[model samples]
Structure formats: structure tokens, C-alpha cells
Target: MDQFLHDHPITPRTDAEKQGVVNRLKRIEGQVRGIQKMVEEDRYCVDILVQISAINAALKKVGFQVAERHVKHCVSHAVKSGEGEASIDELMEVLKRLSK
Candidate 1:
């Protein structure tokens, strides 16, 4: 077992990538606030549901982007270093949660 495998690993991301994720999350935050306002204003139920759906989809997209990065960097590194099983297991666990 690699010593690094048991320890937490840090994945370095570029400033652009960080900013992109931040931008996406900010938009989602705004969407959520809009939904709250819609509720306060007594907007149509179906319209509010539609906006909620959009926010859910947006959040899933952001999650997938992060997962892709995790697989490319963390999983690949673990595999190359002969510590793939644990990393893959961790990834699969999170994937299961994401699917739900």
C-alpha cells in the first residue's frame, strides 16, 4: 500500500477551472434565490417546479465536471501508483450517491 494512498491527496486545479466552477455555483445560487422569490410572490406552481428542475440539472452538470476531473487526475494517479482499488472504490461510492 502506498503511503500516499492512506493520506489525503490534494488535486491542484487551474485558476480558470476554479473560476468556472465558482461562476456556475453562483448562477445556481441566484437561481435558488429566484425560486424563493417566486414562492414569496405566489408564482404559478408549475413554473416554480420547472425552475427547480433547471437548478437540479445545473447542479448535476457541475457535479459531473468535478467528477470528471477527479477521475482524470486522482484515479489515474492512483492506478499508475498501484493504489487504484481504494481510489476506484471511493469514486464508485460517490457515483452511487450522485446517481441517487
Candidate 2:
């Protein structure tokens, strides 16, 4: 909840794409708020942990989506502009980390 938006604008997304991201974020926000309530109610440790796992999975799903867009757009643009090798290498490195 303490997140600060950067002055730089996000690359403008399509209505559908933006909505998709927004929906995912909203769901994540609700999950976080639910976790807060769980803590307040002193929920069982395993129950909290299950929620934590679900949140983590949701976050990673979002990460994969963003990563897919980066590869399809940003990296493709770079490759088309003749920076292909560097971009591909960079992308591979990122994919390796993400897959871990």
C-alpha cells in the first residue's frame, strides 16, 4: 500500500491489456487485504501460509504476462532496429531468472 508511482509513464497499454493488468492488480490488492484481516484475526499458521502461496502464484502469473509483453514488443523492436543479438541475450538471461 506504500507503493509510489514513478514520474515516468508506463508504456501506454491497449484498453484490453490495461484492463487485464488492472484486474489482476485489483485481485492481488484484495488478497493482500484479506491477508491483513487474517493476521488481525490470528488465523492459523497453515491457513496464512496457504494464502501466501496463492498470492505468490498470482504475482508470478502477472510477472509472466509482463515478461511476455516485453519479449513480444520491446525485444522485437530492438531486434528489428539491429540490436537483435544484445536484446536476445538480455532476454534469455531474464527468462532464466524468471524460470527459476
Candidate 3:
């Protein structure tokens, strides 16, 4: 697995972007905790499923946002630096998984 993975270096995001992602994750964490509490309190099955669906959607939204940033910054850098093929392959691999 390690052999197949590239050690792609990261470019740091602006402070506001970092903070926004963190804030979104924290809200997702809170939502998860709320779901846990609902389970402990014997919440209805459909209600739990609805919250689960919401969590999945929230996570995917975050994923897409990060992907957009990667394409804009990292992929663009790779293409300019002449490593475009490898970088694009890596992105496509992750995208295939995301689609599933």
C-alpha cells in the first residue's frame, strides 16, 4: 500500500480556509455526539437514520470542498511543475473512491 502511494507535499491554506474547515469538522463532531445521545435515549430508527444521512452528506460536502482546493492549488502546481500525470492519477483514484 505504501508503495502505491505518493508522498505528495502539502501547500498550506490561508488562515481563514483552515479555520473554516476546522469549524465545519467541529460541527460534524457535535452532530455525531448528538446521534450518540439519541441512541442512548432510544431514539426512533428512522430518526437515527435521518441523522446518519445528514452526517454522510456533511462529510461529503467537506470532501468536495477539499477536492476543489486540491485541484485549484496542488494539482495546478503539479501541472506547472511537470508532474501532472502522476498527480492527476492520484486525484482520479481518490475520486473513484469518493463516488462509491
Candidate 4:
């Protein structure tokens, strides 16, 4: 998925909350660069693969965080507006795609 996939219903995050995730992502970005460097340096294949797995896990965690927020806020609001079934079905379809 693209960075900043959706214009989400982002509540004003506390400074700490904002910084925590940002720091994590910055670290992930650095790790990505490190992977590139490793490949350029002709590092061990298995080592590079391990870093790739770590990056994938980090990205999945971020996706889960966004999914949780959407369920709590966007889905909540949609359900409140009497469009719950449709909204839920849409969410389910998206989840199904993600699961794949």
C-alpha cells in the first residue's frame, strides 16, 4: 500500500503518541536503508532476508493500528448513522483482501 493510504479520521494525537509512532517509523525507514546498504555491500543473503522480515512485521503492525482506529471511529460513526450493515460489509471485504 502507498504511504498515507487514506485521509483517516485522525483525532489530535497526544505529543507522546505522535512521537512514539513517528520514531518507530523513522527507525523502520532507517532499517530499510540499512537493508539497501547490505545488499549493495554484498552482505549475507540470510541476514538481508531477516531484515526484510523485520520490516514486513513493522509495516503490518502499522496497518493493524490503522485498522483498529478505523474500527473504533469510522466504523462506529457509520454504524451510528444507520448504515452499519453496509459499512461493516465494506470493512469485511477490505479485511478479506488484507488477509490474503
Cα lDDT of all candidates, in order? 0.90, 0.79, 0.86, 0.78
In model 1, what is the error at residue 80, expressed in angstroms? 0.5
lDDT string for model 3 (1-100, tens) is 1332245435677889989999999999999999999999999999999999999999999999999998887888778878889889989999999989
lDDT of 4 by residue, 10-50 (tens): 24456886687788899899999999999999999999999
lDDT of 4 at 98: 69
Ordered list by lDDT, greatest first: 1, 3, 2, 4
CA shift at 83, candidate 3, in angstroms? Answer: 0.7
Poorest 10 consecutive residues by lDDT, candidate 2 = 1-10
Better of 3 and 4 by TM-score: 3
Query: By descending TM-score, how would the candidates be arranged?
Result: 1, 3, 2, 4
Q: Is candidate 1 or candidate 2 better by TM-score?
A: 1
**Candidate 2: lDDT of 51?**
96
| lDDT string, candidate 2, 1-100, tens digits | 0121122122456889989999998999999999999999999989999999999899899989988887777667667767768767877988898778
Candidate 2, which segments miss by more than 4 Å at Cα? 1-11, 96-100
Q: 2 or 4, which is superior by lDDT?
A: 2
Pairwise lDDT winner, candidates 3 and 4: 3
Find the 10 residues in a row with the least total lDDT in model 4: 1-10
